[model samples]
Target: MADRNPGMDLDLEWVSGVRVNTQAVLKRAQQVQGRKVAKKEWQAAWLLKAATCIDLTTLSGDDTPSNVHRLCMKAMQPIRYDLLQSMGMHDKDITTAAVCVYPSRVADAVKSLKAANSCIPVASVATGFPAGQTPLKTRLEEVRMAVEDGATEIDIVINRTLALTGQWAGLYEEIRQFREACGDAHMKTILAVGELGTFTNVYKASLVSMMAGSDFIKTSTGKESVNATYPVAIVMVRAIRDYYRKTDHKVGFKPAGGIRTAQEALVWLVLMKVELGDQWLTPHLFRLGASSLLGDIERQIYHYVTGRYPAYHELPMA
Candidate 1:
């Protein structure tokens, strides 16, 4: 079973009261930008740390069992053997936090990980991923079905229409049922902030998702035009912080989509480090919803160890 969220019941008063000043939000985003990033051996250490926080993903119309198997293999041994040996981390079992895939591919991921004799978690994106326009019954069934198929974590997208129209109560109740259906599996609420209209909507949705018992509040579905911006993530993490203060439940955070580089990953790790502390830096509490990110992270690590950067093709997906 995954770590329990220990979330409180729907706190309508707190959810409705959530707010964010755009000007202040922009200023804070700017400040985070000005902070120095990890460099030298510290950069390599943070990169390895970032590897553990990655939810190595392969969600595509062309995703095949073969590809998912390859993804699982990558998750089990994210860094190259030579690099791990050189860094003296060969015995450390450095792997990505989790391997995420679609519902139909859940069994494939599980089979691959088990075959590797590894316990890395398999996360399935269900509840009509990237969009939850399916009927309520269908969505709930999706969650249960994914759980039955061996998904240890379920990343479900919020009904974007609800937040766009200011339907906080409806949104909260919907997520509450989804949480129950998850049972022992962790639930990550993807709030596709791009479609939520304003920062205030993003703030309210983040709080409501936490109130409704999301083990983690994710930023986007990764399918949106504008996914996972620094400013938006700051707003969501603040909501997580607020919820933790009120409920003592430490909910996780994931920023999916458009986050594709080592620099970008480090910046996000920096944000979480500054805002929430080291506790949020772990795989159990934070996960980067990414696919190409691992390759870049690998490339950077290779550069650090070999004094030469490998071409993008050197780090193939499969």
Candidate 2:
């Protein structure tokens, strides 16, 4: 694990001064998505690197212990052994960064990973996930319970009302409490960028979340109408770079939802490498949150080894 981000004091001046040029952000995002990606062996290798940073997630209402167990197994061995051996990476100990589930399923995920002797951390979404409309006491208790249930990381959703209303102090205090409730577990604060209304608001929310001690600033809860677009992500990472320059504290970034293909994953990796440099390229400072994204990544690997792509059922389902 990377060093924890012990948050700093809130600077309303810094938070309020944030301004994002929408047109400029869109142009930059286009350039990022337009860049040509590597092919053949290099593509295979970069896709494998993307696999290692995935937070293999199952956030469905119908998620069961059996499915969670299956998700855990897949996280342990994200790629087929033969596919890995074909690239001579079978012994690299490659696996998804972590297994993410709802707070109710944290125990089941922990049990499955433990029974299998896997060390991949269990992450649970708490604080009324997707919609953080719960009461303060209730949200705090939810965090504590998830931690006690063996969750090593907690993904908390910030109250968007504060951000939308420009209540910087209120937002800071709320996230600070969530950080405290996290205790030993790392906390990833979800900005739900799509709901923030404007790019400037997204940048301010990112700054405040980091000021309140969030280990990571995530793009969305994957439930929004718009999730994880490159323009929104660009604003968030720029805030991360700005924060790092000011406080010397490295905060991670996560772009969940709408990222479904190997090509999209490669684009995100490039976004991180180009915007935040090489250090943020690892799982320690970056993560991709998706349920079906891994399957396509695996399919791409299969195609790279073989001459063609395999049918959906050809690869094992998580």
Candidate 3:
């Protein structure tokens, strides 16, 4: 993992004065989408890199131990062995960065990974995940329980009411407490940008999350009406860049939800490489919070190798 972001004091001035030019952000996003994408070998390689950067996730009311075990197995071998060997990448030790599950399932995931003798960190969504509507005490307790259950990474959601009501200091304090609750686990703060109502709010939330020591600032909870979008991502990554400039500290970025295509994954990778440089391209600095994304990426790799797309049942489901 990259150096942990030792949060700094809240800067109300910076938070209040933030502004986003909607037209400019949209134009840049369009330009990024219009750029030529890699083909054949380059495309295959990029898809593999994207697989390694994924936080393979399973967050559902119906999630069971059987499914979680299957998810972990898929994460350990994200792509098919034959496909990797055909591409001369079988021995590269390629695997999803981590496996993310609900707080209750942290122990299950940890046990499965240990049984498999894999060190891929088990990430748990805590603090009333998807909706930070619970009381402060309950939320903090949730974080502690997930950590105690053997979760090495904690993805926490920020209360949208605080951001929407212009309570910058309140938001900072809450995230700081969550950071403390995370203990030794890395904290990935979910801003829920879709509900933040404006791009400026997203930028401020990003800065506040970093200030509160979030190891990674994520875009969505994968349960939002609007998930990761280029315009919103552009703003968040810029905040990361500016924060690094001011504090000489590097924080990570994760764009989650609705990223189901291999091409979309490449676009995010390109955005990171262009905005934050190659350093953020690593799993430590960047993560794609996705579920079905890995399946599509593997399918793309299969097509690249065998000169034909595999049938639906050809590749294992992720």
Candidate 4:
């Protein structure tokens, strides 16, 4: 995906032409995940790759400084040191792609990572996350503040009202503003796809975000009644592929919220491979926005190597 690059100069015409047949897209989405399984050493390898692409997250109402700090510790080394040693991958750099937190807690995440001497990027959700019902100025400022707080990646929710109402151009300009506000930090535009009304709306929003120069077009904010469904993911990634074909710019894709098992991770890995090709397989261009997903993957890996189930204490804490 790196070779494809992230995005090119905005192309409005290409964005407008992107379309999807709802039934066909949904049919393929059903067929994509879990089509295959990697066992033994291969299973271990897939789990490792999934770990790299995870945006290890903790975006709860109960979030506190200590909770964020502990999450950072996990981000620095998602897999336990002894576990890595057992698989002979101890010396390999094995950390989650990034740590995601709310905008106000960006500084805490940054400080924790720095204190640990880890270069893992802190990603902050901004622009009035879950619902971008605020004014555009306020949302852009949120992105700015997060960037100022040392967030290397900023996940901003798009104005779903614009998308749901068929205001493609409005959505485009707003996301463009969010992208600009991010400056050096990569901007991930969360579509909150489930709220966007239809599959067509989801596809259009994805194109608009990419056209607006989003580094990654995400599926949902995870706060929606629905988030990261297979049909939605397939639609978004296909738009990404179309954008790449027309512009040779490969924007990343992130499916956040509700994905929580090792089998689920493997299914997504398979989806990326089958639909978007192996280039989209790495962390640079693909991310799973999840917290519990990691714990499940870790437990499964531990079982794979040790032939025994890991205890509750063996995993990352609640």
Candidate 5:
């Protein structure tokens, strides 16, 4: 279904107004010199919460079947097992919810996570992820294959060209088709906000993606020149929150790419907490699409739990 806007003039005016507001926010953010006001409290809370929510690792780039399988096994073993037990809890307590990987390795990830059953979802990046420069049919096929291969969640990239050109209709059509192809699988639409060039575009993309049937709206693919940033995430979350207020349809947010350190992840979590509130903090409403963030959070968790940091080399890599 097409979005219910009163008229073209109103749509254009609304977009233009948002653009003006976006500029003001950006200028204000740039002018601020000192640290963000709630930075400390937000960072501390995120570090603790991130440890429990993170699924620990991601595998990509020249990673073949054997190596990917090996990595999943390692995650299942000493890493997940030890992390859970150390928190004085079971598999249910620790946060790293699911393992994310390339589409080709969906089966391997599913097999590796079988022991946990549905406790952890297998997320696969589809639709020419990172680039998203492909035919709609091809992208839909990718989502279909991933679902067939047992991916519980499909993360597809939005057509950046359409989004940048203001072809909201074309972008919505693509997302609608992808959502249909996904069947029962959850769909996360990556906005690649860095490529969109402005907060207004990011906000519009978020609204359109959700309207088109995205269960979660994501920031980046972690493969672009610009990855996830706090300001960008704040814009997207604000859009989601507003959309929910108007329509009562809740959408989730995932900030992936370049979110490496515990501090960076915490910053995002803090932004979400303040914008979307505590209700959206759970795994269902939030996720960090990170590969190297786990080790950092694990280090923080170790310090908080045991009073000392473990040896750097001793920490496992996902």
Candidate 6:
């Protein structure tokens, strides 16, 4: 059971007046699905296009060491290392924006990729990631370890149990504490959109998280049956956009889990472009939580640059 703090004050009036004819939004989204993105939204589209090139995955899984080594090496390989040089990206362009891993592996990931020119931040999953059902002290300690291990960003899973039970105050306090525990590291709160069960719940959760001081509100942990989806992302982004309009505060959105293909990445990019405009397209404002999409983007970039696909593809599909 979760406690309800009577002191919690939420002005639901703003959300109440914002009525989205979900059917219409869905219809509009469907109409734009395969069509060419409008000229005005092209910049936003392109940012998403660049973001699609990012691969956020764990390097150490249950797989054999050789297999893990192969995956890691493949993740590091530039699709067209030479072409990137011509484009001024050098050997670093092909590298991911960041390598997300469990907290225990942050040191190795940081050390191995230190030579890379890009200051690719190491992101760690903390606070009993994907479940977040642990005691507050334990969760805070986990966050502390991630920060000490050199994590520039700490991804914490929101307390779904509290949120679902309508214990908004409890959930809010949890995030507030987690944010403090993260210190200077950016905090990304995972809403686990699928488990939240509805767009309305997703929207509410997004609002609560932003209000609670989340640097970014994320979709999933890639550990649930219902991972990131366009509709749920739309809901979260719209809520953030509305909140920004009202409070003049900027928050980011991250759609992680199950986003494996270049096409899927493109779709998300398109959604962001259409819903939140060009401002949220960069890695700072938007991110794709994927483990395998990076290679596909490299393939596409290679095809665009070389006029042919490579014969020996090393990267795996998300």
Model 1: per-residue lDDT, tens digit, 1-318? 336776666677776676689999899988897899978899999999999999999999999989998899889889888898999999998999999999989999999998889999999998888789999999999899889999989999999998898888899889999999999899999999989989989999998888888899899989989999999988999988988887788999999998889998999999999999998889889899999899889899999999999876776563
What C-alpha lDDT, on a 0 to 100 scale, does residue 99 get in candidate 3? 98
List pairs with backbone clashes in candidate 5: 52-95, 53-95, 53-96, 54-96, 55-96
lDDT of 5 at 139: 84
What's model 1's TM-score?
0.97
Of 1 and 6, which scores higher on TM-score?
1
Number of backbone-clashing residue pairs for each candidate, in the order shown: 0, 0, 0, 0, 5, 0
| Residue 165, candidate 2: alpha-carbon lDDT | 98
Off by over 4 Å in 5: 1-17, 27-48, 55-59, 73-87, 90-92, 115-118
> How large is the C-alpha RMSD of every model relative to the true structure?
1.3, 0.7, 0.7, 1.8, 4.6, 5.5
lDDT, model 3: 0.95
User: For candidate 4, lDDT tens digit of each residue in 233-262?
Assistant: 989888898878877888899999999999
What is the Cα-based TM-score of model 2?
0.99
**Segments of candidate 1 deviating more than 4 angstroms:** 312-318
lDDT of candidate model 4 versus the reference: 0.87
Expressed as tens digits, the lDDT of each residue in 240-304 for candidate 3 is: 99999999999999999999999999999999998899988899999999999999999999999
Error of 5 at 163 (Å): 1.1
Model 2 lDDT tens row, 5-71: 9889999988877779999999999999999999989999999999999999999999999999999
Cα displacement (angstroms), candidate 5, residue 313, comes to 3.1
Report lDDT per candidate: 0.89, 0.95, 0.95, 0.87, 0.72, 0.71
